[model samples]
Target: MSSTHAVNKTIQEINEKIKKGTAVVLNAEEMIDVVRKKGKVQAAKDVDVVTTGTFSPMCSSGVLFNIGQTMPPTIKTSHVWLNGVPCYGGLAAVDSYLGATEPAEDDPLNKVYPGQFKYGGSHVIEDLVRGKVVHLRATAYGTDCYPRRELSRDITLADLPEALLLNPRNCYQNYNCAVNLTSRLIYTYMGPLKPNAKNANYATAGQISPLFNDPYLKTIGLGTKIFIGGAQGYVLGAGTQHVANPERNERGIPLSGAGTLMLKGDLKKMDERYLRGVSVVGYGTSLCVGVGIPIPILNEEMAWFTGVSDEDIDMPVKDYGYDYPNRLPRILKHAKFSELVSGEIELDGKKVPTVPLTSYTRSLEIANELKKWISEGSFTLTEAQEEIPSN
Candidate 1:
């Protein structure tokens, strides 16, 4: 059977089973076995949904707070700082955005500690979610109705009536492998890449990543429900720098940059275990986020996509020694996730070891938990309100 051939099922049919509480749902790990044993046709007929998951450090994550009005002399905030990290205060008088990678005022990047953003935004957000006090400072332009020049206070999550984890880019559809071809070691967000391709680091859950299963964003878009940092979340929009249409493989999986999702969830409902503040040595700090998405097996095509294996998913390996942030990276080679996960891959006729930054074990746990949620009727699949951009 051709891989491109369409499957014989409809979204309405899947919704009917969901409505009747008769839908058959499986996690990505479970679907792998089912597809292997029963084949795609039979598996598609048996499964109504497949849940996918990933837990990795995403620097593009952030939190938004709607702090209620202050005491007398209510000020229209012009400058806002949370735990000494400058937050975006241009929204409303009481709104701010605390970015994950935003550094502290005293620890500004310089020649001494270049790119080392130690302890600032992400930590403050974590503290707030954990019900700890965080120092808040704000300066405002006085107004007749809300007259105050400055205010300083310590606040907790309870002080804010509304707080949300609004990450612009949470789960990447696919990512490139980082390898060091030079003689010296390289420090990167993907962890440390050894010299001369001694070891390669890739950050992805492979078969269980949300966007990996729905490479084209077919069934994932605005309003899709997800498991974010161990709490229920929703896809708000296409994430920043979301590469819509990209080069794909024979299995229709993206070879490189593809779709991304902007997720929003209640911070109060999140658990600290799934939302840890991580500081990469020599690099900046980041928030390790755990995200899971239940892909509705609306049709056999969707089922087939969920059944994609590591061997079928190919990703490019880039030279981390190159100026990746400022310029396009030099692609050293292209290898499948299976090859990368095998602990070794051939690069320039030499075998190089590899490591994974994302935890497959945690990903499996999240997927299985989500599977239980769907089976127990605690969670239901949601249809995307709009198709994600393909640009």
Candidate 2:
């Protein structure tokens, strides 16, 4: 906890400013311009909070809710399904979790690799948030206290009082741009990859992503309030497969996938637009969740970090055609996010078309929304109860 610059602020001080309607907040994109003009030291003194955001396909997202108890309170559900998709029913008799990637039990290609998965948990989540009709079914072993063995009903999200989004991993700090080196086309979570490295796809909002703004996770940790799915949410802890230290440049910019965040929020308060379900032609179902975090300019160093531009970020290009599936340790190359967003990049002396699984447009929208919330004193930053681990 040391500072490299001669400026400092605190979360408490920022919250006081929020209460007094005096906090100077900016989104990550705007912070770059401020840094360019005023420099980090001046920017640190001028800006109180910098907000970052992302809207991306997160396979680890899901919701946990307690369906209303059956009549006579006798249904001890042992299995559960929503709109033909299976849900984890082991939590409690009436509590269950629906994973974003769980294919519908009735999906024709549910078990086939590289199959067209039309619907799954993400769709179910969207339906719940949209207030659409959803069918609920369950089966249980009858007992003295729980006499019901089977149950079925049509329900909506409003029927559940404790529907909490418990995403296990999300908002990747950085990510690989996937390409196919093989002669034939391939389908992956990154999307379709044309044969022979003709196309590339990536995910992340680059400089605007939450963890990217706080590269070291110094200010983000347990209980940190965040903007998630258009609702107020909290950081639960480190995400699965989190990497504290990855390859970085001289400026400490990570050139590969690094840290991740686990988030939790009440789904009932979420906006439907920020939580859409998606299905890939050959891949499976996934949730496109919006996430935003406000990073306080605790020091000049923090301000400098928040000013990271797309040009400063580099990400690895990997071969999903072979290396990825084989778990081979190889990087095809590295490309700047600036170049990646330009819709194309050169690899192996060839121009390859590029796309992003994460929506930069939605990301900016989410960031601006958070900025507005802070400006209106409707949101304030929180000090982490515990710091996120690096390793």
Candidate 3:
């Protein structure tokens, strides 16, 4: 055969192999019908609750935590556990599981779950993490800005067991994620900590570090380490110091408090527009900001203690608490639970190690569908085709 013909034959063989590889990996689980994406628990029963499909954001949920200060200036610690574990542990757990090999038992976060199917709470995992329970407080001319007592909580993986046997068929069908914040430092860009300062916050370095100094803070950074969330400056507004003149008194202008001073450098980042607000935690001695994700606000005392920078993506805060906060409660008692496990693995009196249908698997299947959709649109690595149904 001619050299050209031989080359063409070799090319054909290579193309055939590529097609075979893409066809299917028999070992990998295949999904049939699933709904992927985040959603809210719309209704509740005993075993499972319903939520909107990925196409809707009405019920999407996220979380945040305050790591800026050791103790918030004026905040309180109220209900600690809200269905899940501490904010820091949650992040660490998810990252660990995603990066783990067969989910090792040695991982510190592995003990967070009581059983494979149980949800995590602060009471079970607080002892394993480095954190404190203190109240935070701050004042605007001696007046409290926002007041809400909260408990700063954390947790680890020894908390959940069911993760190993994740429902496969419908894994991505519906969204069910638990996000957490850790010492992972996100980078930020800002002019300086103090306004009109000739020197930068870090004279030698231009960037802020991700680690906070607080013992509760999990990640550790050096040199350029800056905490993620914390209040930097007092809102400043100035008025006449003394109205000694009779004309000033007649005008009803006795004087104004020091002008509100907002630190111009750092900006707080939140998940949605609704989560723009600050809360007092650590028993009312600290202040940290929280967004709509319903993450705990770390007291400013902690933020300052950690030397967090405002430019970090993890610390974005909405101005004037102008945005709405996540209204979803940590645990909606009204949520329904379908497919309640009978512990015997028997759905209607048949012995089985596992059930065929599971919400978790359905959620994963949905995610795969969305991935296919992205690839189909030629927006990803997959060949161009058509959009997959996200609903």
Candidate 4:
């Protein structure tokens, strides 16, 4: 081979650039373009950009080349690890049931009722009051590789990550707001299609009033409790959302971040829902008292990675640092989206592209640094910089 043949390949150069902080991230197409420019005939290109940010709710931001999308490259796939297990991240149906009903008085005793019965809904049961639900869908892209629906028992108040617990009062306040909103949306605003599973007299629409007319309702076997139950799968789905906040921003303008993620399956059972509202709403409250972690701030002393004894979670969010708070979630979301869009887990180095994200999530309550970096394509390694020797 000629002496000129002894040159470095493009990918190797790019990897070195990444390691040295020259390039933030590069996708397949861009990597190809960079390789071609290197004057190398067959340089390898393995890295793929998970996605990009079009517009973000966090301080208005967008990518230059991709003018219209919410995030760049439109995050095709994402992954996350929950409880030490790597799971693909995408849009899963985050739902909760209104609860079951029993026979009520005034109605004649029927086979379903026990002597003029006392009717109740799932939410009415104090034991099932916790709302943190898990919605894991077995898909082709999950880290496990095999297809299976994996879910966590009910998520208790203790299961919360501290980033959410920034200000105990504010965290609680946020929880209340989220819970109240959930109660109103799921119960009052969202009604059952058919009342009593029938369309007959007194059945204009079976509502929650039979119990106490409480807007808030919970599901049985769906509370923040632990139960070893098997999971099932159903149809796959997709969705999108955009909003313009008028009360906060000075522009009085409508800014939005619109993107899509795949929902692996329908809610075959209560055990497979995200229980999103409940989880966010009850973070630091009495609901999560002693079982798991608490709401966390973007940065806090108690928050660190798994090996970092200063904290509890094996992979705490603070490890990623505040600069990347959203990194983990973004990666997980991307992995899920990729599976939805392509039907498999995308690779990033030896990992499944998602391991980093999940690992990062467990790093701290939130990595504001990672979040900013992904959403805005910018982040300052302030913590690391502070520790660096000042020359």
Best by lDDT: 2
Model 3 Cα lDDT, one tens digit per residue, 91-191 = 32121111101122222343553212122221211211212232222212222632433423332322322212110111011111111112222111111
TM-score of each: 0.92, 0.96, 0.18, 0.17
- Taking the tens digit of each residue's C-alpha lDDT, what string does model 1 give over 1-391? 3253445766667767766778898888678887887777777778888999899989999999877785653878888998888999899778888898887787655346877766868888778778889888999888898788888999988888888999998898889898887798878888877887899889899988888788778888888888988899999989998887788888888778678889999998988767878777677778988898988876677777899889878988998786576678867778999998899899989998889888898988888878877777777777789889864
Model 1 lDDT at residue 195: 81
Ranking by TM-score: 2, 1, 3, 4
Q: Which one is best on TM-score?
A: 2
lDDT of 3: 0.19
Q: Mind giving the per-residue lDDT tens digits that candidate 2 earns over 244-359?
A: 87878765777788888899999999999999999976888999999999999998889889999999888899999878888974887889999999999999898999988999
Name the runs in model 1 displaced over 4 angstroms: 1-21, 71-73, 107-114, 323-326
Residue-wise C-alpha lDDT for candidate 4, range 33-97, written one tens digit per residue: 43344322222222211111111011010000100112222222233222222322443322112
lDDT, model 1: 0.83
Q: How many residue pairs clash in each candidate?
A: 0, 1, 124, 60
- Order of all candidates by lDDT, from best down to worst? 2, 1, 3, 4
